[model samples]
Target chain A: MGNQRDSIGDSSAHNIYLTNGASEGVRQVLNMAIRSKEDGIMVPIPQYPLYSALITLQGGTMVPYYLDEPKNWGLDIKDLEYRVKKAKDEGLNVRSMVVINPGNPTGQVLTEQNIREIILCYENSILIMADEVYKNVYSEGSQFLSFRKVLNGMGAPYKDNELISFHSISKGLMGECGLRGGYMETHNIDPFVEEMFYKLKSIELCSNTIGQLGTLLMINPPKRGVEADEVVDLYEKEQGEIYGGLKERAKMLTATFNKMERTSCSEIQGAMYGFPRIHLTQSAIKAAKEQGVQPDFFYCMQMVNETGIMTVPGSGFGQRDGEFHYRITNLVSPTSEMRATLDRLEAFNSEFYAKYSQ
Target chain B: MGNQRDSIGDSSAHNIYLTNGASEGVRQVLNMAIRSKEDGIMVPIPQYPLYSALITLQGGTMVPYYLDEPKNWGLDIKDLEYRVKKAKDEGLNVRSMVVINPGNPTGQVLTEQNIREIILCYENSILIMADEVYKNVYSEGSQFLSFRKVLNGMGAPYKDNELISFHSISKGLMGECGLRGGYMETHNIDPFVEEMFYKLKSIELCSNTIGQLGTLLMINPPKRGVEADEVVDLYEKEQGEIYGGLKERAKMLTATFNKMERTSCSEIQGAMYGFPRIHLTQSAIKAAKEQGVQPDFFYCMQMVNETGIMTVPGSGFGQRDGEFHYRITNLVSPTSEMRATLDRLEAFNSEFYAKYSQ
Candidate 1:
């Protein structure tokens, strides 16, 4: 227990609250953090829909910062500064910034410099909620770094800043989303806030012990040179194969999407998804309006119906005005099926553009 | 998966969202049902602290009704009626009432007629959250009926009333508090509210799948029969011995507490606790005030410090305006330790009262 608590502290100075999943953790913390109508949270524009949906449910304001699409879907420090100032100028108390690293959808890993810049911009008052659930799944050359480490290195500006970093067994080598285990580590938060969090956690009594046990198992791991050598070796080999498969498929899909007409896409730098930007023609937009849906949503729905391929629309994730995109996961199909998925995407795009584009 | 969705529908129709544990399920539905400001939730005075803490954290108002201590800790419909009316008159919208069966601390299980009478007090507009976590643990002659079933039998005032009945693996044979799996069944909820619940559930994504797996395992017990006699018999014998041991020891503890001079203790009914109401003397109360804690909280702290016994304070659970009490779970130690715990309690009570009574 002491070791676990120490690990938690090593995560962030504040208390660690475990949850059923990072999704539940995010929602609960967001609810706890934003108490009043005047309180708002700022998240990246191309963020996980979970944030906006939770913010909407909690009746908190959502301020958004657009990722720099031309800059490999990277965070623009200027945009973060602009949004923070904009929120304050508009009389919204922007309480926190939500950052997902090995970022979702865009899958861009933040540079150490970028991490420092983001922390410096926060002004030591607004808390930073760094979602590092995909920390273990980065590309071969991209080593995962904790925001805690990032802040710890920057010593002076961030030592006193409030930060909550979330990690999950579900995404790591475990690949066990069904396990639904994750923990949040908070740093530099007031003891009063930690007290409230304790009450809040007790409200759930505790997270499912099975998941917590699984997490404990993950953390402690098996002893080195233990008896079950073959079992351990097989588990490691399967994990390596899965990782290699994901990386290759991610590459292929990104290249295919980019080659398509009027379409833009990004490589999966770290996370599981590839989000491709699609430009719908005026006729398609009109048709989508007639169908009472966003063009991309309508397009995705059509693709799902036609090919049984499901993708979340950009609107689900935050997007800039009139910008359209759809997220596809590398986990969707086996390698044999990927060719079919690509062929279908190419067919649908050609057909959609032929009828709608001038 | 289909079976799970079907179960969800069955539960949703019953106004139940199965949760990671009854603790979490209770929190979610209660938060959904209670008022975050002007609305008050009526809980049994000397109730579980879980309800009060959650209500306070969610920004809801809490209205308390004292159990009729003279009537074997049964619900005093008059106290509830008075509290409800008073809260409403004071402009607090009393949204729901929480009834713990085989009461957590008090350990009193109500009769069917008593349940019906309470149900009659709250009609269609107001909901009742029935915490029947100890259904399977009742004494042989003690009957346990679902509030939903009882209300259905009554067939008039409460026939169409909204109710949520909760159950958990934490309290039954499993005693698996760490696993955190439980469920609630709902009845007579509004469609829009039902839709809102679905949306709310989606916000947490879902309870951890392993917890759901536990729930599944619970509802459909293992099919291992006489062929697997050793395993089944071992489980059965262990449970029987544990239950038998609890019943015998609970009797001993309560009998000894009642014999103590300033203590009024209740008999254990169905749940795993024995809440002995301790009457604090003037001097003890004065000393407690000087120490700056509730008399019971002070007594509990002393108990903890002196004996290394970790029991919750009655003040943590709500109580009548002037009454002081403390809760002790019967699961203190093995059968051998029962006499020692009783001796400790008796001495603690006698000395505490002797010092305080004047």
Candidate 2:
């Protein structure tokens, strides 16, 4: 717990809530922030469907801001500002904005400058929800700078800006998804609101004790002096191996997608996914329209049928109109198996393009 | 899974949903059934607060029907009829009704006749939500007849009545509260509505796999033919001891409450509670009002401070006006320890009553 607090600039125990997963924490925040249909939550266009789905479920207006895909899926603070302004102009209260640091589908780690700009864009007008579940899963050159760290470092009024940063055992080196362990740390949230959050959480009794234990283990892993040298060494070695493997797979997946015909992928800086943009021919789009499906969905269906590689269509996650993509996880194990799967996907894409182009 | 299906009258796997616990299942059902404030749910008075709390959370009107305290907390179909009629008359769509079999707090197990009468009362007009988590916990001579079983037994319209029955590993013989494992079985529900339920469930991904495993183990425990005779015997022995202990404690607590001055408790036929009504004097009520708390709460607080025994005031759970009651779990271990606790409670009650009377 002390290690957890230290990691996040001395977050008080009262401000941290252990959840079933980061998903539950996000839901709680959404529930709290969204009082009516006019309450808006700013979401990334190529976002994880969870955000859109939960926003819809909570009856909140989704003010979408598109990621600049050409700039390696980076946030454009101007786009966020415009969206919030438009939402406000349309008489919607921009209650909160979600930032998936080390992004979900479009996996680009937000730089410190990008994060600072985002905080500046929103200020204290809206709560910032930083989904930092993949905080530890960054690429070699990329770094995962937490919103809390950046906000705290920027003294006075900015530091007091309300933020809720989430982390999970399901991601990072643990990948303990089935264990359903995660937590949210609130920064500068009102005491009354925190009490309400606690009351809402208490309604569900508590997250499973096993999940809580998993969260504890994840946050406070074996350290140098706290354990036997051998134990600490083994823990560090295993963690490093997992992190390294994930990074390699992410890079390999991105490279494979980029190599495919009529497809391009931005660098997967962090997170578990490689959301590749697919360039479908007019004929292919027409065929998908005839079949009453989005082109990306049709393409994904073909890939699943032909190569047995499952991926979610970009339409499931909102995208720019007429632009198509598919979200594929880089979580396939054993480098050789992953390579074979990627190769199969490449071959299938080529044939599908050839057939559709004709 | 097969055993689970067999236990609940050949329920289809598609109709069964494993949840974090029966609480989660109940919440899901409430969410599904409650479309708006106009949608009313019939709840028992002195009910499990989960139902009332969730109903309010879902923004559904709670149509309460009182259990007959003089008749050992038995359901009065006439009372339910009156409540539903009253709600309908007031422009509420009485969509569903909740029945906690082997009741919570009240500890009443509805008889086959009561179940059949209840079905007749509602028929196809309303969905029946049977909270049967305590289906396996019942005192001798008081059999637990599931609403599903009784409904199925009555031919034609009654058999086709929409029903959702819940069970949990946290209750009964297992008492694995922290495991957070349970399930809900839907009966005669529209496939489309079921599909909607599935979609809602998918939004949360899934309940933790460990909870699901616990559910499977709970529903499909080792039987005589499935396991070695000795293993089966040992399991049965342990299970019997636990169930016997619960039953004995329930009886002891009920009897002790009955023996107390200015107190009364119905027979503890099932479940794990003895909600005893306390006869507070006018002076005590005045004192409670001055302190700005429920009379029962004031008394319970005094009991906690004096005897270190904790109990929930009946005000938290809706009770009849002018009545003061407190819910106490008959889960205190070892017969002697339970006896000692009862003795302390008796002493505290006598002193408090004497002081208040004066």
Candidate 3:
């Protein structure tokens, strides 16, 4: 672990603490990193709620940048720069940016160029805490690259950017969310900052030892000489199939949703969620207001109540002003169940439009 | 859970969120609860360090009441009242208090009367996050009493106090710390506060499902209907043996330490640690300074480096001025290894004194 971290150009990489899950990791690290004065974190507007909630708990401000929904959930360098500049100008002590690769809700993988641009544009020496736990689950023929790899490929200004990469055993091959296992790998970090991380983690003592064991398993899976080639091949093959299924299901769902009137969704190239925009009618919005619920939330709750399908409302993840959306995870029974869920969503959308939207 | 909290006449009891371990539970709830402006939490000095670290993270203040080390690590009610009033008079918003029964570091179990006094003093308004994870390890003839039980039994101001009881699967019969399983039971909390807790927890979605399953196992253990008597007897017998062994070791270690000059340690009535006062000689302190470490840290690190005995420093947990201490968990080894530990500690103390005093 020490030598591996040293090789990564992070003198304090060895000091990066582990947690039961990325949630706990975020809570601890952010809690340590954020200050009420002169410390804040930037996150994508349609990002994981963990960043916002954890940041809130730490009494730190959250600076949000929009992921262009119309542009396939792509990162716009201009939007990023604008948000960072705005936050700084407004006296929000921004310090770090949380990037979700194979993004949550809006599941678009960043292009290598996008990654390089992010490094070059964010000039204030701000740290990047990359959530790359979904790195292993990319669709075949689509090359998934680590931020570290891209940075190393860039070889200069980008390579020197401070970054902390998070990985998990829950997402890719095992889908072992119940295991509550994850790790943070720091690259090109300062020594004193690393010591602070250790000091902060020491308060919580250590993460679940079992979860750490799972991390060990993920990092050092059965290799050649240690395990049979046939067994390893079977494991890899199973994961590949799972990845293929996820990709196919995501594409099919997005395409199907887009076919519906006033409903649209971005292509889910990576993560397990399909965040679809559902245009609510004026009547529907009025009806939802009467019931004291956001239109999307009302739609989601109604859909769940009627069809027994659960999907999070867009308000759960921040959204653009007046733009309604809901996030549905792709894990809904991959075979017949997913089709049923898609069908239910379509039917609900139509019914909702007829009754309220009209 | 909702009905149970309502029935208890306080919503906080029902608002208890479950986590993979008490550490995570405490971190989350405390972080959430202490977010208000003027929120200050009173924690016992020589605390489990998690308190200070968490309060610091949340930008909350920690008002500490020193444990009466001379009185078997007893809670000084006068000191507690003084601190509480001082904070209040100073306009610091004192929100809650954390009491670790079967105290960490120091293993003194609070007497029923002592608990009653604490409850009366708190006046039921202050939220109490009672950590009773070590309840099962009380000394022989000293039954562990829940704060809820004492509150109900006495029918005083404490019956109205917002109490959250925390328990873990790590320290009791299973000793499965690696599993990271625990639950918090809340009593006498506000409904709105409970809802807030729910909303906060939803931000993390849920604790590990398997850990929740383990909690279910903990709360609802197996019962053999036909072989009830045998099963009961078997359980009782195993518990008795473990409890008996722990008490025996506690007695042995306490007696041995008490006899040593410049060293004094209280009897461990409960809990897994022995927070012993290491009477360091001037020379020993000088030597530790030369090594560039806190005396206690230097001592503990030396113990770990030379003897492979891992122990935490008192500085990690807060301590009185100039009082150097180290936490020694009773997990050194079984009976034989326990003896070896005592021997090593004794020899180390003698050598340390002779070298320093000389």
Candidate 4:
């Protein structure tokens, strides 16, 4: 599946482990790395809950670094360095750093330079967990750059930095989330740790056969000359349509969110979500506190009740203290359907603001 | 899926949780119930390794109660009670007991009397985990009796005993192991504990959609009038043939092992395996000790090397110290093929005895 032109160089079969889903792979890595509360995992604030949840489940310390939402949800090397240093100061052994490129919720694709800087910052101090499941789902100008590719491009010591990159058939064009097909590729990971991973995986016997087969087809789709020309053509056409539709939906969702009052959304550069920061009035916050829930959760619940538009409250995924945000997917199909949903959301936001402005 | 005619009573939908496989359900329960080393889980010796492995992973104390080999691998209530008492005396909380019925590897079906005695022994002190994946795979004159049924029959106090009964499409006549489909039914479990289970399961989203659907079909197969009669007839015929073939193989395997020199196998009343105790000579034991491996492992390895037939060492499943045993599955298809394999086993066993007897 690697392409030299894209700088995603070769990966050996021995280093790859097929999992039920990217979540399973993520869980295994967290479980392997975290031994106690002393072991810390560096995660992004307003992150996918899987990382935080798994860390808590494994009894590990979460050393969170806030993503720069003002900078279109970009990674700040200084913020990461600060978090790691602070965690270390607290007597935590920060074992791993999780980087969700083409970020979940905050869907900004990382630049190659950003990736290189993060690699240099962590070096060999922590294992890099690269969650690049949305590698194929990028906005027009924001191309996906894999951590393995960036690390490989760097020479000697940097190249030897341990990294585990995850990909999923559930994301990208396949959208086979229900099938639970994904894989993790280990790069420069210690041989002993790799063996431990294999041992842990073998405890479950194997991933479901259907999911494994789906992963195979995803990574190695029909090639032009290797298969019937018509079959290859149909495959390419369908894949292109899916990608194009996703790109269009992402753009429309971002535009719609930006247009809403008291709400600001970073560009949906990649992945399926658009996490918009909502500016709730003091009364709304007070009302939410009275109800014993986060403001974002209250807003989301209200939206759901009023318009039947479900959203994930940003509190579920750890956000900065007192900040209100909600994650909405661009996956509502038929383009027109998504447009209608956005229209309802905009109307709801206006009514909410008017009701609570006093 | 419950049939009152066979003493398998009705189950509510709210109580059932679909899993990737019976293994996953077992892992979840172990994870939920085991909080610390002071929490003890009672597991049968000569048990399926899944229980032992999960208990160890969860860092819980494994209080083993050995099943009687001489009495056809029957559960002894006194043995269980003794183990529980010993664990409790050691300052451990005896949390749960695992009963693999229509036993794995041991292949014995529990009598209704035995099941009732077990329920009375533990009562409200420990939760019962019934691994009933092999409930349908029984020999002639042997019946699969669920612990749920026996407990319900015992009236109020026994019916209120907490139990989690697991069933799998991977076992029984389905044998869809690779598809990874199973479900666990919670009976009289604490509402709060059940809620915690739901929360734990939600971390992985849901089991694979395909596996869940497979489990649905397994529990609710087409009825004669509900679907085409031909389809129902075909399903019944195939299921019957598979069951009949397994029963025949189980009987044949038991007979062959009993006839072999210095080996004794109990009746294969149910389940898919034959656990035969191999009488390894002193010289053989000495040789195995020198090689730093269990005697049964050494014997199984030699058998594999000579005959290309693989069997799991009894040591893997836990057994009495100094006892040599191995678990061989009666899953080889076609009566003639199973017969040939048995002949090979007999020949290899004789040769092994002759070489090591001195």
Docking class of 2: medium
Instruction: Return whichever of 3 and 4 wins on TM-score.
Output: 4
lDDT of 1 by residue, B251-279 (tens): 87778878888787866776888888877
Q: Which ten residues in a row have the lowest lDDT in candidate 2 chain A?
A: A1-10
Q: Clashes in candidate 3: how many?
A: 9
Residue-wise C-alpha lDDT for candidate 2, range B1-358, written one tens digit per residue: 5334334457678988888888989988998899799999999988988888888887899999999999889988888888888999999999999999888878898888888888998645589999888855556678877777777777888799999989887883657777777888888998899999998888886788788888887777788887999989998899888878888898888888888899999988888888899989999999999999999999999999999999999999878999989999877887789899999999999999889984
Ranking of models by DockQ = 4, 2, 1, 3
lDDT of 1 by residue, A13-124 (tens): 3466777778878877897888777898989979888898888877889998989877778889998899889889999999988999888888787777788888888765
Task: Look at candidate 4 and give me any clashing residue pairs.
Answer: none
Best by DockQ: 4
Chain B TM-score by candidate, in order shown: 0.88, 0.96, 0.90, 0.96
- What overall lDDT goes with each candidate model? 0.77, 0.85, 0.77, 0.86
Off by over 4 Å in 3: A1-16, A37-40, A136-141, A224-226, A348-357, B1-13, B33-40, B85-91, B137-141, B224-234, B278-325, B354-358
The TM-score each candidate achieves on chain A is: 0.91, 0.96, 0.92, 0.96
Query: What TM value does chain B of candidate 2 have?
Result: 0.96
Provide DockQ values for all models, in the order shown: 0.68, 0.71, 0.52, 0.75
Ranking by TM-score: 2, 4, 1, 3
Superposed Cα deviation of residue A221, candidate 2 (Å): 0.6
Candidate number with greatest lDDT: 4
Q: Candidate 2 regions off by >4 Å? A: A1-8, B1-8
Task: Tell me the tens digit of each residue's lDDT in model 2 across A1-358.
Answer: 5334335547678878988889989988998899889999999988888998888887888999999999998988788788888889999998888989888888899888898899887556579999888855556777778888888888778888998988888884657898787888887888898888888877876787788888888778887988999999999899888777777888898888887889999999888889999999999999999999998999999999998999999999888998999999877887778889998998998899889984
Lowest-sum lDDT 10-residue window in model 3 chain A: A2-11
